[model samples]
Target chain A: MTSALGAGLEPTLDALRARRSGIMCKHWETVEAGLCIGEVAGVDDVVMRADLAHYACRNNRLAQLGLEQDQFAAAVGAATSRYGRRRIGVFLGTSTSGILSSEIAYRQRDPHSGALPASHDYRHTHNSYSVAAFVREYFGLQGPAFVVSTACSSSAKVFGNAWRMIAGGWIDAALVGGVDSLCLTTLYGFRSLQLVSDQPCRPFDAERNGLSIGEAAAFVLLERGDAAAPGNVLLTGVGESSDAYHMSSPHPEGLGAVEAMRAALRMAGLQPEDIDYINLHGTATPSNDAAENRAVMSVFGAATPCSSTKGHTGHTLGAAGAVEAVISALALGNELAPAGVGSTRLDPQFGVHYLFDNRSQPLRHVLSNSFGFGGSNCSLVFSGAAP
Target chain B: MNGVRLYVDGIGLHAPGMAGWSQGCEVLGGRAAFVAEVPPLAAPQALPPTERRRVGLPVRLSMAIGLEAARQAQVDVATLATVFSSTGGDCDNCHHLLDTLASPDRTVSPTRFHNSVHNAPSGYWGIATGCRLPSTTLCAYDATFCAGLTEAVSQVSQTGEACLLLAYDTAYPEPLYALRPIPHAAGIALVLAPKQSERSLARLEIVPDAGLPGRMEDAALEQLRTRVPAARGLPLLQALARQQPAEVVLEYLDAFHLRIGVMPCI
Candidate 1:
C-alpha cells in the first residue's frame, strides 16, 4: 500500500498501508550523456571521447586526483560547510594512491641516473590520504581526517567509520564521500585481470560480458538524529566482513557476503523482511553477478526487490559504493525508484523482484552493498523513518 | 596474568629501506614508519620490464613483506587468510586517469586501470604466493592501525584459519605531493593464527573512551600501552603484538573510542 499524493499520479502512499516501508532511489543516473554511456563499441552519440588510458598516465598503480590542488578544496566547499568545522572529517577510499604521478615522473626522468625531472612535484596527490588532507584543509576541518583504500570496498567502509563516530559520540557530524577519475593504470590493470567488459556491462544478465569502468566524485552529509533536519535519512547500520577466500573473487557460496548482510541486519535490529529494496554491488562480470545473486537469494528469499545500478553508472570503483549510497538516500527521501535504464530483460538466473520503469511510492529502509576485489564486504542501511 | 605472550612470529613491511619483515623488523624494532630510502629490487633482472612497469610501489612492498611473513609464520597457501590495508590506495593511478580524461585528449592505459583497484596488492599476493585462502583489503583513513588489527582478529576468531594481515601506505606522488601527510610511511603489520587458536598470542580488545570522543588510531594504540604497563605497542598496534603477561590493554578511538583488551598467550 503506497501513499496517495495529489490524486496519486503514481502509487498512493496508502498503497503502502500494509507494506510498512520500502527503499526508493531518487536522483540516479541511467547513462552518461556527454560521454559514451558505458563500454559499448558502436555508440550512436558520444560526441566526444577517448580511449581509457590515452586520457592520462599509465602502468603505475598510484595516480593523482585529476583535480587541481585548490579546485578539489573548492569542490568540497559546500560539503565542508554542511558538516560544520570541528565535527567534519574526510574519509576517502582508493585502490591506487599516486601511481600516475610516478609514471609521468618516471617518463620524464633523466633515464641515465633514474632521477625525476625538474618539473616533477614529489608531493603526489595520489597518495591514499591526499583527498582527506585536501578536504581537511579545504574546509579547515580540525577533527580527525583520514582516507580508506580498501580496493572496491574502499568507500563503503567510509560509511561504517562515520556511523560509528556518530553513534560513539565522536564528531557531531561527518563529511563522508569518495572521488576517483579514470586512469590508464586502472583500465590496463583490470584488462590484465581479463575482467574489463569490452561492452557496456550488463550486471545480472546471463549474457553479461564484464565491467565497463567509470569514475565519479560524490559525498553525503551524515548528521546525528538529534542534529539531523526533517526528512534526513538515518545511517542505522554498517556491516563489514572479509572473505579471506580469494583476493579478487567472492566466495562461490557467498559466505562472506551473507555474513556482512547479516551483521548489518543485526546491528540495525531489523530482519531481511524489514528491508524494502537493495542496491546491489553487481559489477556485471560473470563471476560477480553469479556470486552476488546467490548471496541475495540466500538472504532475501525472492520477495525483496533488487537492482544493480552499475549498469546505468558503470562500475565507478572506489566511488561506486558512495555514489550508490547517496542515490539510495535520495530515493528514500523522495519516495521514487529511478527506473533501471540499461536492464532490458531481467536476468533469468536471478529470481529477486525488480521495479520496472520508474515508480513513486513510500520508502523507508534501503540496504546498499559494496563488495570489493579482496572480499572486503560492507553493507550500509539507511532509514527514512523518524526512529 | 603470568607469561603475557608476545612474539614477533611474523612481520612484513614495505618501506624505502627494506621489504622483508625480518630485515625491517630488526631495523625498526617491530615499528611501522615512513621509509627514507628504497633499495633496488632484490630480483630486478628476474621480473620482466613489463612486470616492473605494471607493479606499483605498494604492490612491490606487499610482495616483499608478504613472502617474508609467509616464511616467518610458516604460512601454508592452501589454508590461510590475508588482510590488506592502506590509509589511502592507488590515488596516483586514479589521478592520472582523471587528468587524462579531463585533458583535451583523454586516453588512459589499460595496464594502469587494472592496478587501480584497491585489491591490487592482495591479488598480486595471491598470484605471487599462489595462496588461494580467503583475503581482504581495508582502509580506515588514519585509523589503518586499529581497523586492520580488528579485521585480522575477527578473521582468526571467526574462521579459525591462518590469516596474514598486511597494512601499508606510501607517499603521495607529485603535483599532489606538494600536499601534506605527516610522513609517507610504508608500514605493514601481519597477524596470523589458525581458527581462533586455542593457543592465543595476545587477546586484543577495543575499549572506547566515553570522555575523549573520536581520537585517531595512534591514540587507541597509545592508550592500550598506557593502561597495561607491559602492553606497549608502537605505530599504534605494536603494543598489542608485544603484549606481555600483565593485563595488556589498548584503546582505539574511531567515531567512538574503543578499548581493546588483549589476552596474552599464557
Candidate 2:
C-alpha cells in the first residue's frame, strides 16, 4: 500500500502504532480552497519504467510505487507461474482515474479552437479501466481485467467480484485492489459539497466537521481456497448493497450499511460477536460518521473494538476499501487494535466502542466497511488462517 | 478460468440504427439498413420525477434498455441484480463538470456531482425498480462489453440467480472526443439466468481464446464494433439476431478473447 500515511505496510503500521497522522493544510496546485489534504508524499518523484511509457500518469505511477512495495509484484509473478497468466483476473477500483492528466491537458488546449494538446492519451490515462490495464501489462498477465468505479466502495466490491468468478469456476486466482490519486476534481468537488475539512478530520467526534481527502494504492492476490495458501490471511466473506435512497448522501438510518454488514456476517457464517475488530468507514463528515455509528451500534452493540484509520491516512476515496482491508489484515497479523487518531474526544452520544488509542490484543476475524456516493455500500470479513 | 454457461433469457438493445431486440436483430441480420443518427432517449417514466430530471445520457440509456430486457423476460425488476458497464460514463456530464471546475468559480453543482458517479445509473435503476440486490458498475475501456458479459455469467452461475448485464457507451464532447472518438451512442442489455427457463432464448458459454474476436459483416456495423466499446458485442448480438446455434468471439483483454458458443433455444 502507498498512501499519505507513508509507503508500504511497515511504515503505515508504524505510523498507526505511533498514533501519527499524515494530513496537512491544503497546498495542492490549483486547489486554493481552504481545506486539508492527505497528500501522498513524493509521487511526483516516482517515475514509470520506460517500457510502460504509454501508461505513464500520476495514477499508474502511484500504482507502480505500490506494486514495488511489500513484494506485491513478486507475489503476482508467483501466481502468474501457477495460474499461467491467462487464468488470473485483474480487478481494481478507482474514482478519478487519471482525470488530472486531462485536467492538465484541458488547460493546454489551443487558445482559440479549444483543441486539446496533441499529447493527450485518454485510453492509457483518463479512462477508468486504465489502471487495471496498466497493472495487467506491468505484470504481463493475460487474464480478464476490468475497473470497478463505484465511488469509495469500488475496491471492496472487487473482492465479491473475484469470489464469484473463482468460486463459479471461472478463474483460479485473481489480483484485486484499488488506486486513486489526488486530483483537482475530487478536492474541489468535495469542497463544493462542503464535505472538506479545514483541518485534519476528527472522525466520530462531536465536533467532527468533514473529511480530509487523501489518495492511495493497495493490492492483494487471491488464489482459490484450495490453492497453496500464501499466508495466514483469507478473505472469508463480502456483501454489497445499494441504498437507492439518495445520490451523494447515505441512507439516513444506514439501511444499506446495516444490510451489508449483516449479509457479510451471514456469508462468512459468523456472527457479529465473532468480529474482533471493526474498521469504520468514518470519513469524519457529520452525516457519514453519524450514520455509520448507528449502523455499527445496531450490529455490534457498542462492545466491539472499533476505530477509523482515516484519521491516519485520511479518506483515500476509492482506495480506502483496499487500504483499510490491508489495515485490517495488519491489525490481525500484528495483534494490535488501531485507534481513531484525530478524535481527541469520541462523541459520547453515538455510544459505539470508538477507540482513541492503540492496544495489543489477540485478533481473529475483522470487518471493514466502505460506502460511497450513489449509495453504494460494501462490507468485507477477513480472517486469520489460525484456529 | 472455467467455462460458466448461462441462458440468455431476454435482450434489449439501443443504438444509432437499432432500437429494440427485434429491430437490432433485423439490422444485425442485414435485413435492415444502418442509420447514422442515434435514436433519442426518453426520460424514464418509472423513475421518480426528481431522479429522472437529474440523470444524464448513461442513466437514461441504461434504464431504457434494462427495463426492456426485464419486461421481455417477465422478470420482476425489483428482484434483479445488475452489472452496468460503460467506457466513459456520462461523458457529457464529465465534460460539463470539468468545464465548471476549470473556471475560477470551481464549485460544482450538487446534482452534477451526484450524477457523476459511475454507478449513478445502477442507483437510478434501483430507485426505478425498487431493487436492493447487489449491483456493480464496471469499465474496461473498449473491453467493457465482454467484461460485463463475463461478470453477468459468473454471477448467474455462482449464485444461481438471474443477472442483468447492461453495456453502454456515449461519445465525449469536443476535447474528450479527440481522444476517445466514440462517434455515436450504443447500449445492450441481456437477462442471463443460471439455467434454461421457458423464457430462455439461448444457452451461452464463454471460454478464453487467442487473437481478436469475430467481426460484423457490414462495414458500417464493423466501424461501430471498433468505435463504440459496447458495440464490441456485435458478434454475440449477430448470433442472437440469427436465432440459431452459432459461435462468436469477443475482444476481452490483450492476447485473449472470449469465445462465446451460443445454442439458440427459442
Candidate 3:
C-alpha cells in the first residue's frame, strides 16, 4: 500500500509499529477543506512504461507504484507461470476511478468549443474497469477480469468473489485487490457531506469529528491452499450485507454490520473468541465509529482487541478494504497488533476493547471490516498458517 | 471442478423497441420489429416517492427489469440477493457532478454526492425491497454482462440461493460521450436458480472458450448489442425467444469468451 506512510509493506509495518502516522495537513490544488490528507508523495513523478502510456492516469500511477512494491508483481508473475495466464482472474475495486483524469480534461476544454482535450482516453483510463484491464495487460494475463466499485466495501468484496470463483473451479488462482486514488470529487464531495475532519483523523476518540480522506493501491494474490507455503496466511471467510436502511448513513444500531460479522463467523465455523484482533472500519466520523462499535460489541464483545488502522494510514476510501487487509496480514505475520494512533481517549460509550497502544502477542485469527456509503458492509477473516 | 449448472427461470430486458420479457422475446424471435432510437425508461413503482424522484435512468431501468424478472419467476423480491453490473453507472449523475465541480461554485449537494457511488442503484434496490441479502455491484467495461453472469452463477451455486442479475448502461452526455460513446440506454435482468424448478424457463451451461457470438440478423439490434454493454445479453434473449436448445458464446475476457449452452425447458 502507498500512502503518506511511505511505500510497500515493510515501511508501512515499520510506521505502524513506530506509531508514525502518514497523514499531514496539506492544501490540495483546488480543495480547501483544510483537512489532513494521506496522499502518496511523488505520484506525478511515477510514470507508466511507454507501452502502457495509453493507461496513464493518477489512479493507474498509484497502481503501478503499488505493483512495483513488495515484489507483488513477481508473485503475480509466478502465479501466471503456474496457472497459465488464461486461468488467473483479475478482480479489482476502485471508486473515483480515473475521474481525476476527466477532472483535468474538463479544465483543458477548448475555450470556445467546450470540447474536451483529445488526449483524454476515457475507455482505457477513466473507465471503472481501467485498473483491472491495465493490471491484466501489465501482467500479461488473459483471465476473466472485472472491477468492483461498491464504494469502500469494493476491495473487501474481491476476496469473496475470488474465493467463490476458485471454489466453483472457474479459476485456479486470482488477483484480488483495489486502487482508489485521491481526487477533487471525493475531497469536495466528502467535505460537502461534512464528513471530512479538518485535522488528522482520530478514530474512536471522544473528540473525533470526521474522516481524513486518503488514497491507496493494494493487491493480494490468492491461490489454492496446497500451493501456499506452511507459514503463509489464509483467508478463511468473507461476510457481506446491505444495510438497506440509508444511502449514506449506516444503520443506527449497526444491525447490518452485526449480520455481516455473524455471517463471517458462521462461514469460518469459529466462535467470537477464536478471533485475535479486529481491524475496525473506524473512519473517525461520529456516526461511523459509533455504529461500527455497536456492531463489533454485539459480535465480538468487549473482550476482543480491536483498532482502526485509519489513524495510521488515513481512510483510503475504496482501497481501505485491501489496505487494511494487508495491514491485518502484516500484523498476523509480525505478531504485532497495531494500535489506534491519534485516538488517545476512546469514546466512553463504545463498549468494545479499542486498542490505543501496540501489543506484542501471537495473533492467530484476524477480522477486518469495511463498510461504505450505500450501507454496503463486508467483513473478512484471515488466519495465520502456522497457528 | 466442473462449473455448476444454473436454470434461468425468468428474464427481463429493456431496449429501444423491447420493453419487457414478452416484447424482448418477440423481437429476438423475429415476431416484432427492432428500432434504433432511444426509448423513454419507465420509473420503478417499487421505489419510494423520494427515491423514485432522485434516481436516474439507470436505477429506474434496473429496478423495472429486476421487478419483471422477479415477477416472471414468481418469487418475492425480498427473498433474493442481487448482482448489478454496469459499464458506467448513472453517467448522467456523474456528468452533472463533474459539471458542478468544474463550475466555480464547487459545492456539491449531499444527494448528488450520495448518488454518485457506482452502487447507488443496488442500494436503492435494497431500500425498496428491504432485503438485507448480499448485493454486489461490478463493472468490466463492455464485458459487464458476461462478468455479472459469471458472478451471479458462482453465487447461486455457492450459496444455494436464487439471485437477480441486472446489467444496465445508459448514454453519457456530451463531453464525456465523445470519448466513450454509448448511444442508448439498455438493461437486462435474469432470475437464476441453483436448481431447475417448476418455473424454470431455461437451463444454461457456462464454460470458458473463445469465439465471436453470432450476430443479430437485424442491423438495428446488432448495432445496439455492439454499442451498449448490457445489450450483450441479446444472444441469450434470442435463445429464450426461440424456445429451443441453442449454444452461443458471449464476450468475457480478452482471450476467452463465455461459452453458454442453452436449453429451453418449455
Reference contacts recovered by each candidate, as fractions?
0.27, 0.74, 0.80
Clashing pairs in 2: A170-B1, A170-B2
TM-score of each: 0.63, 0.98, 0.99
**In DockQ terms, which candidate is top?**
3
- For model 3, residues A126-225, the per-residue Cα lDDT tens digits are 8899999998989998888899999999999999999999988989999999899889889988988999898999999999999998889999999987
Return the lDDT, model 1, position A360: 73
Kindly report which residue stretches of model 1 are placed more than 4 angstroms away from their true locations once superposed.
A1-87, A96-117, A168-170, A197-199, B1-83, B87-116, B121-165, B169-266
**Once model 1 is optimally superposed onto the true structure by TM-score, how far is the C-alpha of residue A138 displaced, in angstroms?**
0.7
Best by TM-score: 3
- Candidates' C-alpha lDDT: 0.57, 0.88, 0.89
Model 3 TM-score, all chains together: 0.99
lDDT (10s digit) by residue, model 2, range B123-210: 8887787787889999999899988988888888878899999999998999889888999788999999988899999998778888
Instruction: Supply DockQ values for each candidate.
Output: 0.18, 0.75, 0.83
By DockQ, the better pick of 1 and 3 is 3
Q: Pairs clashing in candidate 3?
A: none
Q: What is the DockQ of candidate 1?
A: 0.18
